[model samples]
Target: MADDAPRRDAALVALDWGTTTFRAWLLDGTGSVLDSVRTADGALTVSERTDSARARAAAFEATFAWLCRPWLDEHPGIPVLCAGMAGSNHGWAEAGYLDVPAELSGLADRLTVVPAGDSVVHIVPGLRDAGPDPDVMRGEEVQLVGALATAADRPETVVLPGTHSKWVRLDGDRVTGFTTAMTGELYGLLMRDSILARLATGEVGPKASAAFARGLEAEAAHGDERGLSALLFTARPLVLAGRLGSAEVADYVSGLLIGAEVRHALRGDPAAVVALCGPPSTEDRYRLALERGGVSVRIVEEDAAVHGLWRIALDAGLASLTPTATPASVLTAEEQPS
Candidate 1:
């Protein structure tokens, strides 16, 4: 395809509108990105501004119009598919959840369409594990579907490490069940507000250092999840005793948390090859811990948000509904940062 082609030729717009971040991609057929945009106008900000249901909906609609104006204007009448918190109860529209053991193929059938001026918007539903213990997830389900769509082997576990890390399991094409660990969130609390904040003063960057390796060793030696409370306290004591440096405390604490998370998640199957997805730095931490635990890792570098939306759009039959042309000329709206 020619690079100068009009935006009207876009296959569709893929949106990953989450709680704290909003990302959109203008894609052509075969799922190649023609253009992309990202903003901080996440659901949290939009939801906080409104009081009533009517006001909330209006707020969401207005936010969407502003965030997506340039792309929507460029590609008039194009279909838009979104996956994430944007479909949550607090978001633009509640798309609800699909129960576990759910097949990836069935995702499209549950899409909730809401009108957006001349364009059409489809919200992908979240997935739930309605077992003896009930749990729900809004966004990661889409990424799982996107990751597994092309896997050669039937992946048993897929780990998405972030603020709230998710460990998802699959039984063939169906998502069997999953679990979440508040590893990143805990790290934030400890490093930002807790007593350990002083020790984490310097930049640790991405690569794991000697101190990080020691933290992993400490976790391995501790060998019990219940002992994390005691382990966390070591950060201060080690620094006070001059056993661990103040600067290295940051990476050390990261290693400790990630190591603990990896051990807990793989408690069922230590040898399982886990598929990981996230930003490079975050995933690198998880990979270090997983490797230390003797678990193999596969980093999925593809844009899961885009791929997932595109796949679900195909399932919803909206990909075929994109108009070839619209009479209105593209609006020259200057893109604004959120």
Candidate 2:
């Protein structure tokens, strides 16, 4: 009788198809990841690398098949659930955007399915903020769905840190609104092109926690009329005056930028509970920034994309047609592996 229990087999393929990378995860009914795949076959790659109009039009499908060839050969006709830029206007196909203040369950209904040979591919739509100042997010919304679904508390702030960091406001299991900060992109420009570039040299590896802390403190205590622009000049002068050194400039700049973002996001209420998502490498830096601003942060695993795709697949009834899960199995790709 005990043996009669239904066996769980690998059910579906969860794909987080971004602008520069394509990541896949094999998941079971219980939402456990079985195996995974990652490739540089992203939306831009397909658009720029392919030759000819026919090839370019079929770029998404062709690149997908090439990357998942091995998996397709092994698993056969498993349904693929994709999220991120793959559904953007610049990707395989445009899935449009669902307005903010939307629920996770409703996201399934808006999925765009593209017939790809034997296996079907489903793309999750992005979210739009229909406010006075309009804004939109393509992929992070999927991760937001997954993060909110697993959270124990309601109405928590979720921060997805990257080239353009997103500060999302979740309320009653719905993503109410969000704001973006160009922290990472600015950091790159400063380190590569700005005056800070002169001294912010050397192999910048693991975060200089102490220097980062200093930056956070300085950013937090900054009381100036010029805002960040005025604050940035201090970096070079501190080095020349021996107040700050050359080697620590990068980390300090990172802290300053991240700290400024945190300070701005948590303005008016600094003690808010925040959930930090995305790559772990930047999580600690963000976590430190938030803490320095008197905010409490909970680090969410980077695999929220996998869970989000699975949940949407289930909601869209795509999971029902896929295979079943097999006992517990786990495999992972290093988040943002260098």
Candidate 3:
């Protein structure tokens, strides 16, 4: 095959469409990525750019066509599997949710189908917890599926850290329950508009690591008794007292917030080892926090979404493996074609 030749083995187009990021992968019969596209054309952005529901849907369709035109053109009738906010009520199609304790395998049976130009898109439904304290998640469910598939051991607890960090509890393939924390959102708010942001200067560097550790230690010690409000306030005073450098304030605050989240999450659902699935930077921070909380960590591949979409596609009969198809190992970040 030429470098630019169309892949006749392409079996599925996997999409991970979130609030502010869009990623699509063209996968072969064995789930190896043949081609991929990533952009900032998220569901939220697409919704905001349009007025009415009709316009919003049209915009989403147009965006999808624009991004995957080549793949759709070359491989007509190829199955497209999407997971995330794109299936939300306000998104291209309302895929709805499966209330917990839902079986992970059953997700393949409840896909929402949307006709986009000449292609049919299968959107994965989100998960919902409807007890006294209710919560819902859209995109993280697929990541969970991927994480479990690629995990060395099926973890009892899984943490997907992001803008809204998810702490998921699973028994085998069943998702018993989960909780969401506003750790990342809070960090963004404080860094962008809080009083601490005024004093924070310079990039977080090697010196910031010690400050971050201090914040985690402080949260572990005083977060329960003194409260997070008091712990966060101490950041300002430490800088004023010539103890913490201005540049280290961001990492210090990050440590405090992530530490508090980890401490509380572990207390609620203690586990021996937790599967941490996320980007490298976010995973590093959570690994530190979780280890500090005395739990062993197993890092799931960051590109778990692609693997997840592949699994769901196979189970749903949207795609199939060929007899001649050779299984390929998951590609690392550097190994993926640009």
Candidate 4:
């Protein structure tokens, strides 16, 4: 007689679907990544291609199926969990929000399920700060969960840098409140459409680090008194006066924007230590600014999304730690199970 048991170890399909990017990972029972994929099929892109809500949902479903076809075919009925704009009002399905003072552990229970072919995809809920100054975040919450899991000591503050930088305050596992700043968006505007763009000749190079430091110093000196508008205009004069190179304009602008954001964020919520969660590019800049502000920084990997999704899967009873088998194609020769 021949043995007829399951041979695949892939337990869950983790997705970090955002505004302009879609990333997925194949995780085994132990939360180790077996394979991964990334693309530009974001929720916004999918929605823009369809008009009606019904059509949009179908498109999202089709996109998910197409992206994870290989994994799904190899491991039928594998649990799928998604975090980010995919659960927003205009995305696949509105997963809703867990208002501030919300506990992170409760996230798994509030998931919204969307049926895609033979798989049921669970979407995580966004966080809402419904105070005098309102703010909302979709995908950063999962990063927070993963950051906390990997931290030796709990950080009072967690900053997620992106187009809209988020300053999140955590009291244990519960989120008390949070704020958002348009630092990255401002950098994009100034480097692309503003007057600074005309003078920006090439990519930010090694020499741009000095220019970036100058921008940080400039912002630190006059940002509070003269305001960002006045300080931003000085970039043009610096270039014309031969003080700043045309290629360095982008880095200088980035420094000014990130400087102001870090300064003000600290003033609002003073923290002795902050856990910075973002990609290497933004992480290096933020680490510089935060250290300059006299705050110790703890760095978390950008791939926190996969760990976060795995945690939620276990909490939701969607995954287990029991060793399992996975398709031979999904694993390298060294990763093959006995």
Best by lDDT: 3
Candidate 1 wrong stretches, greater than 4 Å: 1-8, 223-226, 269-271, 321-338
Give the range of the ten consecutive residues with the poorest summed lDDT in model 4: 202-211
- The alpha-carbon deviation from the true structure for residue 139 of candidate 3, after best TM-score superposition, in angstroms, is 1.1
lDDT of 1 by residue, 133-246 (tens): 788788887788778765667678888876678888888878888888888779878888988997777755777788888888888889485487788889898999999899
lDDT of candidate 2 over 81-194, digit per residue (tens): 889888877677789998987776778998888878777898899889998978888888878878766777764688998777888887776787888888887987889998
Higher-TM-score candidate of 1 and 3: 3
lDDT, residue 236, model 3: 94
| TM-scores vs. true structure, each candidate | 0.87, 0.84, 0.90, 0.90
Question: How does candidate 4 fare on TM-score?
Answer: 0.90
Per-candidate Cα lDDT values, in order, are 0.81, 0.79, 0.90, 0.89
**Least accurate stretch of 10 residues (summed lDDT) in model 2?**
328-337
Give candidate 3 regions above 4 Å deviation.
1-8, 202-208, 324-338
Instruction: Judge candidate 2 against the unseen true structure and give its global Cα lDDT, from 0 to 1.
Output: 0.79
Give lDDT tens digits, candidate 4, residues 260-304: 999999988888989999977788888888999999998998888
Which 10 consecutive positions of candidate 3 have the poorest summed lDDT? 322-331
Better of 2 and 4 by TM-score: 4
Off by over 4 Å in 4: 1-8, 204-208, 323-338
